[model samples]
Target: MSDSEPRMIEILRILSAHDKPIGSKLIAVELREKGFNLGERAVRYHMQVLDEKGYTERKGYSGRVITELGRDKLEKGLVYDQVDFVYSKFEEMIYLTDFNYMTQKGNVVVNTSTIYDESSINILKKIIESGLSVSPYINLNEDKSEGKIEVTTLCGTTIDGILLNEGISSQPQYGGLLKIEDYKPIRFEELISYKKTSLTPLDAFSSPNRTSVLDVIETGDGIIPANFRLIPGVGRKRTLDIINKLDHIGIGGVIGISDEGRDILGIPVPEGMVGIAIVGGITPFRAVQENGEDIDIKIAEEIRNFNTLSPITTKITYHLKPVEHDIQPKISFLLSKSWNLIQQVNFDIEKRKGDIVANVSYLKRDDLDETLNIMESLYNDNPKYINPYYKVLDHPSDDDKVGIATICSLSIDGILINNGVICNPKYGGLLELTEPPLFIELISYNGSTVDPHKIFIAKDMTRITREAGSKKILASFKEIPYISRDYAVDLLDTLDKIGLSIYKISKPRELTYNAKADNYNFGIVAGSGLNSIAAVREKGIDIHVKAIEKLMPFEKMDRL
Candidate 1:
């Protein structure tokens, strides 16, 4: 690549980041932020050259746009390689959770050029057939940025590494797998109306196409408004027909919903039948063969009773999966384009016995560099441990990157991408409202386990709950991920609305991520656990803080 190629790639990156067109002046501003010293005039010259080469299209007063060719270059890792990239903006974390969890248990390491390569389908089947667990490795290069001289395999690796090693590689990316007939796409508007009809997230999700181990029984009549086809479609008859056909194949279920949810969607209403809008979410049962082999899907449920929804953002889940492919390129592209943004984020790393728990006060999709540093530090510091600790990265972001990095990092177990404060970038981002965090964990690589008690999350949870009593404490305010601060004013106001005592919890080490749902579940234990008062009475405040600290360093414990 030519020397100017890097600068051109940067321009293309900026253009692709935002949905709207951009101008040379704006591009110049971004370049300056990225440590470039040039003025807008220099950017204009570059833009002109890029325009001639069909890399960008000038949109009159709006600005320039990256063309398909430019996007191809960026996606293909020409001048702007996805490997060793940084990011500030990102898509939802749930996708990251899916990518990481899906690949972590495999024995083969399949490397796909892009997320769309059809080879993943074959690779997955091969894993099943060979009965070998596999891990998909992205980006072949190592991150020597942390001062390591050897070119080790960080997380992202080139396809050549796959071909050279025992790993597998497909031909250069042609396109995504042809539309798999497994799922039938329903109208978006219909689904939206269905959600409004249910009024509950649990009831709403039950209507989607999914698979699980056990079928949920409904509390009332199982019919949901979405279960029936609507508008330009047939109604109950179609849904019944589909359900019957699916059941005939062994997928047994009446109306699609949990027994309790049945009443929520259909039974509780006094009005006439709301009818089914769609008939789906049934997983055809696989009868065990003579060898007793069968695909047994395990169903999971969200624990909300003990979980507290707080601050304005309330919840950020990287736990959800099966995101649409059309929106995923940005999930990967987000970090590569917003490298500077990643540097602006903050996080802390701690040891949980044999695992590393990283609690990020705030994060975004592009800040991957910092996450890698933490993971490598954990791995290097404890060489005695076979694989070190089961690595965990937890962060909140609008578009997420830290967890994505940790998820893709070497020797990691699983991760939950949390969304922090999210504000429209077009609106100048949190303005002057962002608050100085209660604390900032300096990113440190190469450190021993922070706390010996930080072992299996269950043991820690048991200790916390036993010590905790009836007083529930919620300490937080609404704030954007890295831009603005969420004020304690909201927290105080909330406490006033509901009578409650204040108990401060101290945060000393890295907030640990113990459960697959641990990242979010810890918030529940801290915010709404009935054991809070019992723990206070049993252990007093100092010990209480230490007890909780074993699981996580509670920043607002002092406030409580």
Candidate 2:
């Protein structure tokens, strides 16, 4: 599929998606609304070709409807996706992205990457403004309560929503906006921009991963503090560029950008921390000079000179990814590949004065290759080990294939444990009643999304919990599921390298779980879900019909 696939696929999609047939004029209108310039005649011609090709059908008076064949073509040709990219320097980027992190108490800390090129801001601004005007879905926050209905552009939005358009466009670099030789870089702000996703040079961190940058304040004369130099990504050039831009605008805010960037200025934090960041890619301390104020730079240079003389310690935590096929060979190859890739690109995979050692354990590897491949194809991005979704899967069931397929279906990294069958309320004598089997395969590596690798039992239940996992994990007063282990064994093996620790303690006082309620379902509790409905049905409540009867009142009401 080339650049034209989007329009052609969209035509098939809109036609097949509609309940009734749509005319060529209507299809052209839909395409134009999504920023395509195709006219009615061109659309009609495409429709005729599609009919000739058995991809669409045309009734005498009615217009076009997509055939099963056409739908298949559309599905294969165009894929829908949402993804992120990290920009390093001009035309220098690799496959990487960040996830929305949260604090232990559960607040959203945005995951963002830098655009390196200052000139890209001009491109970003243009895209944002234009997309804001054209994209009817992304920037709308309708004040439905207003007396006078005046449609206008939206200014603010909550953080969870994506700012990209729902429609397909004619743009070649539709995923993001970028300019490169023999390639076009996607500027995401224009392609699928979000209101909460937009930021300027003034945006900076307040706490490591606590506050939102959009909440930052402005100084006088529409200028805001942009002291962005402090961040590792900003470096010196971005700081200078930001300062020079601010100087031209003249500030009413901080006389210049402050260390807070736009995070804080004259503004006071209302208080309380909200989000958390993973801080992966752990490494050992090393000496390096960084630019700063003249005196600070001198001190940093001197410190580096002194630091290099000090003996260094090396640390390596191999993720030791497992394979469905060739586990040993893959592990060997991964280690060898790591070493080879290091020396091959002169990446300096090692430092001085440290011997690399291995810590082998009961291993379970999470290879998110299939999901990564699908996403890469959809976004037309490069394929690597980059994953945005991770999991903590277990093989509690005899169905190891289900267990394997469950984790293989995520967008990130994960753990795989063969920890027997999961427990439900109804039946459980060994695995659940006595103590849940939490035998973990303590493999090492880092990535996103900690989906459980084991079964939640039923496929429906796993599906539901997986949806809930995406809801929120860490938060204030957070209580994760109970673990059966005595030590912080899994946490120490996995997250310890990154300096994160889990406080897994035992019950100070324990009560023997003697089978006290034999009739928990009937005499005492009505049970958990549909069974409860069945119980109520036994009580002559007719809950099955009652539930639908309750909705009749709402369905009866018409226009307000």
Candidate 3:
């Protein structure tokens, strides 16, 4: 109805006729050929206008596509004035031999790219559907050795040209006739060679069904008519089985199919056939050895042997240390004497492969009598020592009360207080010792004991000095001495000043009691008057069940 309406309709028609979205440049070319004056910019503007009105939509930056509204309008029919103008323009370009001819069918100008033939039109439609834009004519000039046929698209851009030939051996030259942009060139000689080796299929078959046939073609190695037989009733199951077997044998592909012996099975034309294909070449399997040499046979044999044997379950060994010190002198002595004592006490301990020897020595002197006599007197006279040492040792001390001094030693299983008094009242009295002592005993478990001869002693005087602060008499000798009362007193003084509490003492009776007991599980028996001298003697040490009752109140007496 408006002056621009007819032009807009014409633009819509051009776009609707294209198989793909048409670019503004192509639309401009179409308009130019129709004798209409329009530039690329003007065409682009009209396209945008159409798009805004919902008649067209932008496909990309360079192109536009017809929308549903444009299709509906085309079906309804064009106005008379627009139709006449389109037809007059089409008439100027129409040719008799050209397939794309313009004709008037009522008020519509019917311009078709196909000749007025059903087969030709159908072929054209198929080509378009296949995503190809074909030219209006085909050049068939046999005289021109390298005939040139140029084709321009509606967008005025030349895509690509093809070279036509009669036979497979023909070499394509520049610009013959066909326009094939997607296909790659293949020589007739190659195809013939493939055919000779049964590589090429005689007829096209679906990829899935033609697997065996294709395989035969590949492995034939340029040889022709290879022979092979397929088993009968070879449906999917048999086919798959055969394929797997063939693969294992280094054979591949299906060259030919036949039913040479299916009659014996009473079946006609077996479900699948045995076929002749080529045997594929194989590379021998190999492994690199530690010496970097390729080992094929050895590796294969090893793999075969490994596969034959049952898989072994790997096992790992773990050693758990004693969680709590039982305080039995023999067990504690063994454990403290050597680090390996804990390992030896395990019931499940394995015999070690090598010999384990322990070296031990004792530093003794008569001058230590003074320090030892004082410690012995404290144990005998102190009321705390009247009962048992452990009871006095286990009791808590007053906040401001500094504990007594003592001579102590490291046993295999635990610490040993030689001459000391329990000072903490809760355990009866805290222990005081003149110096750490040296003792020998076999490592033991709940009842079993090891050899005492295997015991080792290593004195850590620095650790003792650090533990016993500078308050006691022995703290003056910070460095350890191999002899004399100065060393003994210094060690005790260092221990007392360092705030180290007395843990346990060395008593031969504790070891003897554990050795004689049916079950070596003995609890500590100590009282407030904890005398270390009496505690060490076999008969003097009394079993104070009351201390056990007091220390382990929660523990069931029967359980103990």
Candidate 4:
């Protein structure tokens, strides 16, 4: 916060960058090179001030080495200096990247982080397997200190170097948190333009409160550090070719490549330029830090021989078998949780702004029949969210008149409960219309006081149409105990035969098309019973919905 604080921080930073003590004369030279306009005497004066503050200590006849306090001060440095430091650091790294993918030779920029805990390394391996890092290749070495492990991961900007090697000009853009679902990229949830920030986006956003890299590895739903870059349109073809080559070598960090104007996730791109999202190289280490392990992260730490690093293999195997637990207590817990869900839906409906019923049962009087027709046509066309049941209400409100109650996905949990199995509904979100549909947004049922599905619907996020494989539809994510996977799958199959819908089910302890479940629980994705109503809303029709309105017997409801 002081005028001289930035300069002092810079002096500390320069000392910290070296492993040995540096003298005032050399410090003066470096300062002048950085446009500081400071001479040796002035540098000595600042060094004396720093020494008095116990930030630096002299070693023999050598100059000064930054102390632990000095390094801490550098970390909490001024934003102006930090930003300038990061930008210059990136420029230097880009200039240093000389690795050639063709011959697989030369130096490539890498990031190194020091971890003290040995157990947290497994978390890093899992993240790499999940493809949430810049590359699967890594180098691990013992630090000078005992019990410290130095992890080297390829920096995302290494791609910039590779591009430059092939004469392709590219610019690093923003570093941000990219949302991942079903182990695939959806969109960026947060971004900080590189030019505006002092810390690398990965370093700035990799905090435990900001990233869920561990959760993403296990459950496939979380935000991870990723960066955007722009390249000339003319180099797009060559750049992709290089990327493919990198992948063949077991190195991958590319999320998605966009065409000329804008990216698929709606990130902007300049004309005649292509934008790309790449997983940050240091992302996997967030798992270590998130687990409360102390780590020192160095972005663009140094260059390494491309051949020296080894491809990351599964070093620790996770036992995916189901654990034995008292099913009765879990059943009670799930039932209580489901009741809370019902209550939340009711509360949300009460506080809802418009004439929204906020459930799956009813629609407006005018669009009820038309929406039912659309649902029928949709089922006839694709057989998803197929419910033939409907009943007209004797008393219709101005908005909630037509009653077309489909079986809410929550009913699946009820069925699982009846069979003495535990099913916990986790999140409600928009499922992208893809070959293997991935959730693009999700809000946890337990964390939120409102119905997540209702919130997404009210925000106009639904884009479901009759056309296949391109938009998002209303869906819910749930997890059943791994032990109940077989019985639950059988129950889901039975419901599917009876016109109830279940979109996907994960393996005993694996992800369901990248959507993650609990630690030992398998994930199940089901179409929201509100799909039909949401589709009608997408048609520009004003409709009210009552999601999970009530639990009516299957036989009591009649076919339309």
State TM-scores per candidate: 0.21, 0.23, 0.19, 0.51
Q: Per-residue alpha-carbon lDDT of model 2 for 145-250, expressed as tens digits?
A: 5422111111111011110111111111101111111111111111111111111111111101111111111111111111101122233244335334422321
Residues 1-560 of candidate 1 have per-residue lDDT tens digits of: 34566678778888988788899889999888766766989999999999898888989899989999878656432311221132111111111212212122212111111112233333323222211111111122223454221110111111112222222211111001011112221122112111101011112232222212111111211211122211112223433453454333222112221121122222121132222222221111111111123222211111111011111111222111121322211112111222223223232212111222222222343534443354345335422211221222344434443332111111011111112323211000000101211111110111111111111121122222232332111121111222122332233233322222112211222121110111112110012121232222233221111111112222222111
Best by lDDT: 4
Q: Where does candidate 1 stray beyond 4 Å? A: 86-560
**Between the candidate structures 3 and 4, which one is better when assessed by TM-score?**
4
Candidate 3 stretches with Cα past 4 Å from truth are 82-93, 96-560
Identify the leading candidate in terms of TM-score.
Answer: 4
Off by over 4 Å in 2: 1-3, 79-560
Per-model tally of clashing residue pairs: 65, 38, 64, 13
Candidates 2 and 3 compared by lDDT, better number: 3
Q: Order of all candidates by lDDT, from best down to worst?
A: 4, 1, 3, 2
For model 3, how does the per-residue alpha-carbon lDDT over 1-560 read when each residue is reduced to its tens digit? 34565577778878877878889899999888756689999998888888888889887775888999888655332323322332233223222112111120111111111122223333322222221221222211122333321111110000000000111111111100111111311111100111111011111111111112112122311111111122333333444444344333222222222233222111123334432221110001000111122221110000011111121111211111111211212112122233342223221112212111211111122222332343355445433222111211222333322222121211111111122211111101111232331111111211111111111101111111123442111110011112232333443344323222223321222322111111222212121211222222212222221110111111111100
Compared with the true structure, all predictions reach lDDT values of 0.27, 0.23, 0.26, 0.69
Each prediction's RMSD to truth? 22.8, 27.0, 42.2, 22.3
State which candidate, 1 or 4, has the greater TM-score: 4
